[model samples]
Target: MLIQKVRFERSPKLHAMMTEAPYPVNARVVVQGKRGPEVATVRDEAEPMPGDGRYGMILGAASEADLDRWAELGREAEDLKWLLRARARARGLPVKIVAAEFTLDGSLLTVSYSAEERIELGALIQDLRGHTRARINFAAVGPREQAMMLGTLGACGRENCSSHHLQDFAPVSIRMARDQQLPLNPEKLSGPCGRLLCCLQFEHTQYLDLLKDVPRKNARVCHDSSGACGKVVKLHPLEGTVDVLTDAGMMQGVPASELRVLKGEPAPGQQKNRPRD
Candidate 1:
């Protein structure tokens, strides 16, 4: 059914499935809970089945009946919100519960909330279980997930990364920033994930393509009779010009075609700079 494997909170091995999911590494699905139906975005997918012992769940596609049932239960989300708020206050816990969803069959209930510390939610779960006669699960998602769920305005004044269409969460390295010659500013480079933005990976291949024929910035080569040889400071691959700081105390731009790249160390007496004078 082209179901992708996904990861859920606490259940690292638990996977969710999606049908015709748009995002490359992400998808949105309706989770069926005992008390109500909830919507969740698929984080990871299981496909080709990685040999790794990672477990996954095929949260099969939601049927039309499931959608209608979820719509009916959505009306009760506000009531669930108020109940959760009152419970947290009674317990003297600083927490905020946003939304709640129940399964199509009203067998499961999932509550979405945010908090700083690990607050005990046993009483809350018990209350919900007793009243709804269904399984209650509380998921504490990070800011990244929060943004995905609630949506937000980004630095560009548009919708945040996940909402706009980012799928995979690849680990970005400082090496990538350096390669792109971007300033290492957390505010400038990081996304709602508080990590390097995933968009940086988009055009990286183009930069790599441009760099293949270019020489490193630290190449040394002899200049004319001036013996002006130093590290390469700049390179224009298309123009074939390489700017090098020479021993003569000046930066000279020379055509890359005119200079021979040294292999290992230059052989002695072959400086190519000593004139017959």
Candidate 2:
């Protein structure tokens, strides 16, 4: 009934597994993963989770021999990765092999790759099968997943969130950048993956909440300090301020709290003429 979080060396995801006894954090344990018996590190202390049938039980604590074998497998996988790349190049296939992982039992080998378009791997898989006795599987990943697997730094000069802590990619769109009033320049708004920055979703809600109280751009408002009506030129949601063009043709930075939105007023540069009867 005790559940613990564990992470595999080849994956960034945290998987829950049943533990027979308590294990300290960072302790190595062997578990039956989807691929096969694999070594995983204990991410946290075990906790009770009743009726948890989704996870499999941990085989046992990893022995010194198991750790040694794990290291050997890592080196083998690296060699296999290079072999795969060389084979692809020989075949004239336009693909970048990102990673290769072998099951603990050495019965299965999984390879991940990225490409501009879909590619038929029939010949490549056949070639690899001939090179090794292990069953070979190839997976194609998108630009974001490729970047995550590569573990590259993002625009903020920090590790990519997908590689560091994010369990899965969130749906990011241009609306998030626009809501935050960011410049629409693609080069500036994109991450190393050439996609919309994932951090855009982090503070989008806060920006929306702040904008609720601020006047929209080019709206008519009255500055309480001078009782002068002006047209809002820009909004500073983060600072709670708005730049206004006063009726006297002067620009002023006024706090949002001091301005009252004047609805139904004529727009700037428009005349409010009397109607003839």
Best by lDDT: 2
Looking at model 1, how many pairs of residues clash? 17
Clashes of each: 17, 0
After aligning candidate 2 to the native by TM-score, how far in Å is the CA of 157 from where it should be? 1.7
Per-model C-alpha RMSD: 9.0, 6.1
Candidate 1 Cα outliers beyond 4 Å, as residue runs:
1-69, 82-99, 113-117, 126-133, 156-158, 221-229, 233-277
lDDT of 2 by residue, 91-131 (tens): 89999999988877888888999888888888778877766
lDDT of 2 at 148: 78
| TM-score of model 2 (CA atoms) | 0.90
For model 2, the stretches where C-alpha displacement exceeds 4 angstroms are 265-277
- Model 2 worst lDDT run, 10 consecutive residues: 268-277
Q: Which candidate is the best by TM-score?
A: 2
